[model samples]
Target: MNAKPTEATLADRHVLYQESVQDVEAEIDFVQETFQALRGRDAELLREDFCGTANTACEWIRRGRAHRAIGVDLDADVLQWGIDNNLARLSAEQRGRIELLQQDVLTVKTDAPDMILAMNFSYYLFLGRDELRSYFRNARLSLKDDGILFLDAFGGYEAPMELEEPRECEGFDYIWDQASFNPINNQMTCHIHFEFEDGSRMDKAFSYHWRLWSLPEIREVLYEAGFRQVDIYWEGTDEETEEGNGIYEPSEVGDADPGWICYIVAEK
Candidate 1:
C-alpha cells in the first residue's frame, strides 16, 4: 500500500497552524513581485494550485488592500490547517480577501487570473503526458489573455537516488529527504522530517510521490498546451548569498551545471 499522506496534507489543521509562517510569507512575496515584473502591472488575483496550508494566500491578503487569493487543493484537512494557523495572523479585512477550497487542480476553475503559480514543483505529481497536458490546458483556460504561469523545477544527474539534506530552523531541525528513487521510471518518494529540540521527531511531516520532469519536456508540453511562449529563470552561481543568487531573466537555454534549479514561465 502507498504510504499514508503526510500530516501536512491539507486537512491537517494542527500542523498548518504550527508551520513556519514567516518563511511562507517571503515566498509569496517573491512570486507576487516576480509576476508583477513579468506583467508590467500589479497582479490582483492569484490562484495557487496544490496549496497545502494556504499560507501564500494568507500572505497575499496581508500584503495589500487590493490583493485577493484563492488556494486550491484536493485535501480538506490541510486547508483547515491554513485557517487555524496562518489565517489567524491576518486581520478580519485580510481574512475576507482569501479563500481556500478543497478541489483538484485537474478540475478547478476560476476567472482569468493575472497570474498563476504552482510552486514547490507540485505539478510533478502527474507522471503521464496526458494527465500533465490536461493540467496545462486547465491552467491556460483559467488565465487571462496576458496572464503568465510560473513553475519551479530542479534537475541533476545525481538526483536519481536517495539523498538527505538538513536545515537548522530557529528551534527545530528540518530535513528534506529523498528516501527512494526508481531510475527506470523517474518516480520517486520524498519527504520532510522535523526534529524538535526536545528530541521528539515528526517523520514525514510532508511527503510526495513525483515524476522528475526535465526542462525540454516541460517546454514541449507548454507549447502543445497552447502557451504563447515559455521562458526560463535560472539561478546564478554565487555561494555568498544565503539563498544563492537567482535571477528571473528570459532565457531559451539553461546552463549545463551538474545540478540546477529554475523556473519556467508560460505566457497565455
Candidate 2:
C-alpha cells in the first residue's frame, strides 16, 4: 500500500526548491554588480517578476537597509508562504522594505524600479511573440529611465531532449525532467521532482510549459520593445570540471555547450 502524504511532505517542496534550485545571493550580486557597472551607480530598488516564494526579494532587503524590493507573482499561496517562511525571518526594518503582490507580471504596476528581474527562465512562460514583446514593454515602463532589466535563459543542444537529469542533494535527489518538446513550435514541458531517502518521491513538485526562445529572437524582441541596448552575460567554466564557475561577464559570443545558462540585460 502507498503511504499517505503528510503536511510536512507538502510543505517541504518550497524548502527543497530553494535549496536545490535557487542561488538568491549570487543572483543579487549579479544584479547589483551589473547595474553598477552599466549605470555607474548602485541600484536601490528592485522588482522581481514571477517571484515565486519571493526568496530573491527577501534576500534583496537583507542586503542593505537602503534597498527595497517588490515581488510580483500570480500565485497568492506561494507569496504568502514566502511571507511566512522567508520574509518573517527578516528584521522589521528589512521586512518594511519589501512588498509582495499577487498580480500578473505583465500588468501589475508599482513604483518605477532601478532593476527588474525575471530570473530562472520564468519569463519563458510567455510563449507568444506578441505576448513576450508586451511583457518587455511593460517591464520597460515599470523601470526608471536608467533602470536595467535582468532575465536569465537556458538552452543548448540537449535542452530540447526528452530526458531526465537527477542530482543528489544532501537529503534528497533533485530531478529535472524534460517531458515533451515540439521542434516546430519550440515549446517544451518540464518538471521538477524530488526523491527522499525513504524511497518516497514528490513527483512534479513544479512544472513549466515554456517556449524556448533563442538568443537572437530574445534580442530582437527586446529591441522591438524599445530597449536602447541589450547585452548577454555569459558564464565562465571551471578549468578542471568544465562546469559553470558562477561568474558571468558581458560577452558577444557564447561557446556551444550541451546545456548552458546566460543572463540577458536590457537597458532602457
Candidate 2 off by > 4 Å: 1-11
Candidate RMSDs in Å, in order, are: 5.3, 1.9
Clashes of each: 9, 0
lDDT of 2 by residue, 197-266 (tens): 7777899999999999999999999999999999999999899998899999989989998899999999
Each prediction's TM-score versus the true structure: 0.86, 0.96
TM-score of 2: 0.96
Instruction: Give the worst 10-residue stretch by lDDT in candidate 2.
Output: 3-12
Provide the global lDDT of candidate 1 against the true structure: 0.78
* lDDT agreement with native, every candidate: 0.78, 0.93
Q: What tens-digit string does per-residue lDDT give for candidate 1 at 1-268?
A: 8875543342332352245323566466567777877778888888888888777677777778998888998989877777887788888888888888798898898877777888878999999888999999999999989898888888877666698877786566678788999978899999888766666667786788999998889989989999998988776556676354655566766666656778788999
